[model samples]
Target chain A: MQHEREHTLKAFDQDLDRLRALISEMGGLAEHAIGEAMRCLVERDVAGARRIVQDDKKLDALEIETERRVVQLIALRAPMAGDLRDSVAALKISGVVERIGDYAKNIARRVPELQDVGHLEPLSLLPEMARIATHMVHDVLDAFVNRDAEAAVKVAERDQALDDFYDSIFRTLLTFMMEKPNNISHATQLLFVAKNLERVGDHATNIAEMVYYAATGGQMTERLEKAGAL
Target chain B: MQHEREHTLKAFDQDLDRLRALISEMGGLAEHAIGEAMRCLVERDVAGARRIVQDDKKLDALEIETERRVVQLIALRAPMAGDLRDSVAALKISGVVERIGDYAKNIARRVPELQDVGHLEPLSLLPEMARIATHMVHDVLDAFVNRDAEAAVKVAERDQALDDFYDSIFRTLLTFMMEKPNNISHATQLLFVAKNLERVGDHATNIAEMVYYAATGGQMTERLEKAGAL
Candidate 1:
């Protein structure tokens, strides 16, 4: 009987591991989409941008699969307490990651529209901003895999830099638009791209909060209070 | 034993009803927030906008409560099949509804910024668009409560009109921006407000899809194909 119980436990662990693997897979695809979208933006690669948009469908499909797995895991295992909470968190994270992919797709869709605009100063800030946002996506998923709450908090902190970049970029674009009225069309597109990256940063922070909660089984704000980080 | 089983079934039904009630409350708050935000925008009611931002906290709190109730229901009931799927869908719909509230808060945040600029033509189109988006939220939640898949599909169909409003408003704002450089700043804010309303419509459609799936025990696309609506 003990051996049978041990086998059941092992199977449950395997199910959980599979769920985490799926989340990591989705995260990898979303991160790659962001980087590739940024590249397409700077290089004016319309075809590459279009491909990124197409690739978002994979992320969408993965999210559905993740949800299916989560429901099946709950129904079959009937996980109690922490295991159940983790499963639910995985479900929510998949949705957030899918949204991150959408933001990347949004950025990509603008590439064709932005092709006519000559190189602008604000464009230089975007790649670095994308890098930060992409890394937050990367590090947050790693935190989920390792169940590291501290690492998740650190990832949330990085959003401040992305926010600052967005503020600076917004001001620069506004000035640029006022200086040359003709720049309004293309400049508007760039503004949206910047906003999308900022939103990606926000979504990454949101995921970090979910990860922290899943790992510690407590609200992230409580963790912050204890660490005097709030 | 039969009596006991009946009692258990009734208790589960009550739990499900309570869950539905929480969702309805959240949906109402989100729908009202959208309308109030639009009113604040058009009237330049900075104080009202601030109140709307502050009120979003209640929606956030309600979502947390809904998640807690969901976890408890699943852990205690160990619901199988459709019951489990419906519970899961309820959890997701709460998240989506909370996001809709956030979009309203976003629109509210811009109210103060727009107070300085004179009224633009696009502003006139926004209230009607918001009304449609707000109604979608209300009708979709009603569909959830009623388990009416057909009603949910009707809500999804309304999104095209919102999309059309957005496109028209976009062109109008772009033309305005190009015509007068001074209009760029305020026009940009209006553009984001329009985009926010459009996003509310998208999220409402997303909830409609979820409601349709939960009600019909099938994906929305399948239902659409069957009805020749696709």
Candidate 2:
């Protein structure tokens, strides 16, 4: 009976490792999707943008697969306490990562439309904002993997910088639109791209909150409020 | 042993039912938030808009409570197959509903900005679009409660109409911005309001997908694609 219990415990560990590996894989794909989408945007590479759009399907498939694995692990292993939180957090974060991928694809779709328009001053901010957003995605997933609540809190704090970037971009784009009617369409598309990046930052923050809760079993309400205040 | 098993099962059912009730409560709050935000926008009721913003905190608190209950239920009960799906679906839907409430608050935040702009042509569509989106939230939550996959699919299909309304509003607002430079700022705010309503529709559709999966254990990829094609 002792040996049998040990074997079952080992199998449970393997199941959890597998779930973590799957989420890490999904995270890598989502991060690449965001990078490629931004590259396509800055380089004016329409084909590259199309590729990111196509690649989003892989992230979608991975999300479904991750959800399946989570359900299977719960049913077979019946994880408790911390294990249960880890499994549920993985499930929730997969959805958020998939959403970040969608935003990347949405940004890519706007690339072709912007190709004909002359470069505007606010376009310079796109790469920086995208960089910050992608970095947040990376660091937050790392925090999840490491079970580091402090790292996750730091990631949540970074979102404020992204928010500031968005405000600046919004003001700049509005000026561009107001200056000339012809700039309206391009400016509006850029506005959406900025908004998408802001949303990606928000998703990253969401993941950070989940990671904190998964690691500590304590709500991050006060911490998040503090971050927001900052 | 058999008696113990039956008691445990009964408790599991009660837990699931409790989670469902919490979700329904949250959904009602979100739907009301959207409606009140729209009413505030149409009536130029800054106080009403402020109320919607304040009410969003309740949705946020409910989401945190829902997540905690979901984690506790999974840890204690270790539900399998259908029960597991129901719990996770409740978890996912709570996040979506919370986001919908946030969007309503975002729309409300713009009301004061719009109050100074006087009436605009595209502003008329905001209430109608909001109505459709809120109705989708109501129906999708109903579908969740009933385990009605067909009704969820129907709700998903309705998103196309919201998309259409958004497109019409987008074009009209763009025209208004182009026709008069002074209209740019207010029209832009209206554009964002329309975008928020459209996003609420998207969140409602996402809930419908989760409901369909929870009910049928089958993906709604084809149905979603069909809706998008329309």
Chain B alone, candidate 2, TM-score of: 0.94
lDDT (tens digit, per residue) of candidate 1 on B76-166: 7778777877898889999999999999999999999889777677799889989988999999999998888989999998899899989
RMSD after CA superposition, every candidate: 1.8, 2.7
How many backbone clashes does every candidate have?
0, 0
Candidate 1 residue-wise lDDT at A63: 95
Candidate 2 off by > 4 Å: A1-10, A223-230, B1-11, B75-78, B223-230
Model 1's interface RMSD: 1.9
**lDDT for residue A120 in candidate 1, whole number 0-100:** 74
lDDT of 1 by residue, A124-180 (tens): 889998998999999999999888999999998888889998999988998899998
Evaluated on CA atoms against the true complex, candidate 1 attains a DockQ of 0.61
Candidate 1 to truth, TM: 0.95
lDDT of 2 by residue, A140-187 (tens): 999998999999998988998999999999988888888877989888
The CAPRI category of model 2 is medium
